[model samples]
Target: MNTQLVESVIQLIRSLSPEEQAILQEKLFFDFAYPSTPDLITLALRGGSFEFLNDEPDLYSLTDGEPIPCP
Candidate 1:
């Protein structure tokens, strides 16, 4: 990913509270097993390797590749 984009993502994550950060990290790792959750937006912004489907407004779905599944 572009360095600028990565920086932007890091900045956005930093803006959230600690609890919100934890929730975002968890959702990024377990999107399929768990139902969609509040942190989906933040996860998408980070741009995992998987291809994402833009189902909801300003939201996306993992269409291809496995989600990174990390915290």
Candidate 2:
């Protein structure tokens, strides 16, 4: 990797506003969480590791919680 390019990216991130930085943080988290390839959830389901969950009874109904009114 080019050292100058790495430093440029750091400078760009430092220039972001607080809100923009927060958004960037979330984007980084989500990229790590799901990844670019098939996600972990899909892999787990296909591997049948969590198939036992199908036997669990539903704990909550659709009407269980009060809905927040979105702006």
Candidate 3:
């Protein structure tokens, strides 16, 4: 670990107000709990399951509010 970088980050975090710290803590927790979409897709592809989504009938794109048009 880079001790200097760690110390700098710690100092920056400590400079935040209590409310800001709480918000940052919640965001970090959420990030740890849920992987990003691209990360999830990568994991699914590695598991040989990503293609199944294409076969599903009721799937929709998360980026756009539009439904996925079936072929």
Candidate 4:
């Protein structure tokens, strides 16, 4: 293990401006922050998790209900 090299790298990171540090941090941890998981809605659809919706009837329409009477 190169302890001196690690310490030098830490010092270099510390010298970066806040914005630069933020960019560096994101670059370092981007994989962990935004993993390659399927989108939630897509996963649900493709996995048949919402297959029950196929059995549900269309119970309401825009014109199905009576309009309210204005006083």
Candidate 5:
């Protein structure tokens, strides 16, 4: 991801409450498969999980079905 976009997402995530943050973390770790779209982003924010959203066609798949590696 681009630095700016990643920064923006980090800012948005920071704005969420701890419980919501936990939900997002759990999804990121276990449920979400990324390369998500704007709609999927919205769904994740609304549902607290990415399970309802479909895989994004353009974004790259998460290799080895693993959680995103930490920087």
Candidate 6:
């Protein structure tokens, strides 16, 4: 982490009005709490390998919503 950049950010935040600071705080909290899908995908890819659990092996009739008899 860059100490200078962090200090700069802190200074900028300190300069904001109370309302603006609160809004910024809320935004930061939300950003950390619920990350975007792309962020999640990147994290998952970095953590480990990804593989499909099932490759759609069911019959085409099953996928077509046909009322097939169940064995």
Q: Superposing all C-alpha atoms, what RMSD in Å does each candidate have to the true structure?
A: 18.1, 8.8, 10.4, 6.0, 18.0, 7.8
Off by over 4 Å in 2: 34-71
Candidate 5 lands at a TM-score of 0.40
Which 10 consecutive residues of model 6 have the lowest summed lDDT? 49-58
Expressed as tens digits, the lDDT of each residue in 1-71 for candidate 3 is: 79999999999999999999999999988778978899988898798867777777975456758676999
Candidate 5 residues 22-71, lDDT tens each?
A: 99998888666565588677886788576545564545555646686889
Give the candidate number with the greatest lDDT: 2
Which runs in model 6 stand beyond 4 Å of their true positions?
31-71
User: lDDT per prediction?
Assistant: 0.76, 0.88, 0.87, 0.87, 0.79, 0.82
Candidate 4: lDDT of 25?
Answer: 90
TM-score, cand. 1? 0.40
Among these predictions, the greatest TM-score belongs to: 4
Q: Candidates sorted by TM-score, descending order? A: 4, 2, 3, 6, 5, 1
Off by over 4 Å in 3: 32-71
**Candidate closer to the true structure by TM-score (higher is better), 1 or 6:** 6
- In candidate 4, how many Å is residue 38 off? 6.9
Q: Please give the lDDT score at residue 27 for candidate 4.
A: 84
As for candidate 4, its clashing pairs are: none
lDDT of 6 by residue, 1-71 (tens): 89999999999999999999999988888777987999989988876555442564655664586585999
Worst 10 residues of 4 by lDDT: 31-40
